[model samples]
Target: MSYTLGVDIGTFETKGVLVDASGAIIAQATRSHKMLVPQPGWAEHCAETDWWGDFVYVTKALLCDSQVNSEEIAAVACSAIGPCMLPVNAAGKPLMNGVLYGVDTRAAAQITELTERIGADLIMARCGNALTSQSVGPKILWLKQQRPEIYALTAKVLSATPYLTWKLTGDYVIDHYTAANFSPLYDVNKLAWTDDLAADILPLDRLPRLAWSTEIAGHVTAQAAQETGLAVGTPVTVGTIDAAAEAVSVGVKDPGEMMMMYGSTIFMIQLTALPVRDARMWYAPWLYPGQHASMAGLATSGTLTHWFRDQFARELGEGAFGVLAREAADSPKGAKGLLCLPYFSGERTPIHDPQAVGAFFGLNLTHSRGDLFRAVLEGIASGTAHVMEVCRALGTEPVRVLAVGGGTKNAVWMQATSDIGAVPQIVAENTIGASYGDAFLAAVAVGRVLPDEISVWNPVARVVQPVAEAVYARQYPLWKRLYSQSRDVAHELGGGA
Candidate 1:
């Protein structure tokens, strides 16, 4: 039987999975990696040491465990986080560690510069996006100003997913789903890179070849085959960002569907008839050709919990999240009048400010660890609620929200999200996040399964409905007010990024 391989490069880990043509997972492996924070705002990754290192280790682990011959692997696909900018030498060698996505905001000054020079409205009109930590254009400008020598010898710029694809096939290609986010470098109306507009920003020809997310970029080479333990000549499909791929893994096939990814950050992707161009929300091409996906995200979700556990409950160990979640779930709906602003990494969607700081409001001496913990959970749910409201304001409410990612393992968080969103969240049976979807893309490429067959492998694990409307109605307004009030203080404290 033919097989497909999906590799997902994430902030905290690299995951690889092997699945049969019918979408049954045969083997799965994970290799944890480190997120480098040389400075508070500068998050980076060693493309060679960590990424390639973890990749080399995990590929063999998965294939060996699956007992599947390398030649049986019909196709390969990769998905990773992005809008990330990485400079590579002319020989396709990395010049520096891979700069991260929104989490790393070292280029905040560059963002301000670009917004002033090009004008936000003009940029929004041309690129369908506003200046934020997530866009690549400003990051590239930062490289030019900060590391001119590296920028001079740069052969191409790449995002996280394309970097992996290039390593596999020796072909530098990026999908439109990713290229569209390159901002001023991409002409929204024309749907192609514009040499005239970005002549001063990026090299026109050095940019990776663009394709739809399903298009096969090239075949795996003997070099990649040796490292990955995969057959040479296996077709490699161009993959999109982790958020987009997760949407595909959970069966976001039609319009009016939303995918909620719960990981290092919280993100929402809703399929829309036309691209939504709000400065608060983002518009990206979906996995299919000519389709658009609307995106919304918060800077902190799971990370806040991780921080709480690491910084506060170090003694609790393995059961920290579960223990805290249980305490929070038992607490009152409002967590006894405490609210958390989940701007720990600054905010993403709806408020693209890196200067925002996370806070706890209405805290009193009477508050216990349970109340604080629950409020933190509720706070992230509230942030997601804001995204749902934005989607509604943009003229689409998802009929059903499909939940995927690490946070899905926590039922309390899932319920909290559904309660705040006021929508039913259907948890997927297989929630391996983007990697699973990447494999599905490979399955499509190899003709092992039709694009429509995704639903067969993706079935719901459970469903949850909103809890209380009155509580959410009051909380949302307060959440909105917090942004304006917190921004000034956040800037003063230099808390963003």
Candidate 2:
């Protein structure tokens, strides 16, 4: 039977899947990795190790575990966290550690500089995005200004997915979904790179050729085959950013359908018939040609819960999260007056404040750990609600929200998010996430399946409905006020640091 192989490089892990032509997953594998935080507001990943190494390991493991013949795999596709910035030399070797996505705020100065120089109105008009940490253009300028020596030797700037595709196919190409993150460099109207804007960031020649997500980039080279366990000449599609693939995994195809990814950070993508331009949110060309997407993301979500587990609940061991979830479930809604601002890594979307700080207001000595944990979940949910509010205000509200990612397993968090956002979330049957979506995209690339077949591949498993909660409604305003009232203090503390 014919099969397709897919792999995705994520912030904290890499996963792969082997799926038959009928959309049944034959086998799956995952490898964990650390996200390197060199300094406050700076995030990096070793491209050679965290990206390529994990891809090779996961691919080999999936092939072995599934006992699938290398030749039987019809095509290969991959997705990864982006839009990351990884400058490479002539031979495609990484010049330094790869800079991560919106989570990394080291380029804030460059973002401001670019916004002032090019004007925010013009950027929004041309790129359909403002100068935020999510944009790769500022990061490119940061590299050129901060590390000129590396910039001088840079041959190409690649994101996570493009880099993986290049290593396998020996072609430098990027998909339109990820290319849109190169704001000020990508022209949304023309659907191509803008030489004038790109000139301000980096040499135009250093950019990779752009393609739609489902198009075939090239075939796996013999060298790549030797490194990976796949056969030579296997076709590799030009994959996209992880969120887009995850959205596909859950059948977020029709316009107004949205995918809420509960990963390291909370990422939201809503399919649109045409681009929606708003500085508060981001707009990009969707995976399929002629489609568009409106996206929003929180800088921190599950990341905050992870920190709590590691720091406060280490005694719980492997069952820490489960135990914590139970405790949070028992805690009263709104965490009994405790409100948290989930800006642990600063705020993205709506606020776009890198200096924003996380805090637990109304915390009292009487509060238990359960209350604190529940507060954390509510904090993230409130942040997500804020994003949805902005989307609705801008006339791009999602008609349906499909929930996907590891965080979906946490009942308390899922419920809290739905309740706070006042939107029901549909969980797909196979939320194995972007890797599974990558496999499906590979099938589309080779004409094994049509784009509309995703619902058949992964149907809605269940739905999380919002329970009317007056506490959350009352606390949300306070949550918003907390940040505004404390912004000066947060900035002062940040400046001191």
Return the top candidate by TM-score.
Answer: 2
Give candidate 1's total backbone clashes. Answer: 0
Regions more than 4 Å wrong, model 2: none
1-497: candidate 2 lDDT, tens digit per residue: 39999999999999999999889999999999999998999988999999999999999998899888898999999999999999999999999999999999999999999988888899999999998999999999999999999999999999999999999999999999899999889998898889665475887789999999999999999999999989999999999999999999999989999999999999999998878888888899999889999999999888899999999899999999999999999999999899999999999998999999999999788899999999999999999999989988878788999999999999989999999989999999999999999999999999999999999999889999999899988999999999999999999999999
- After TM-score superposition, what is the CA distance of residue 11 in candidate 2 from its true location, in Å? 0.6
- Show pairs that collide, candidate 2: none
lDDT of 2 at 168: 98
User: Tens digit of lDDT per residue, candidate 1, span 258-367?
Assistant: 89999888988888888889899888777787688888888878778888888878898898887887887787777877889988877888878887888999889989
Candidate 2 Cα deviation (angstroms), residue 417: 0.8
Q: Candidate 1's error at 298, in angstroms?
A: 1.1
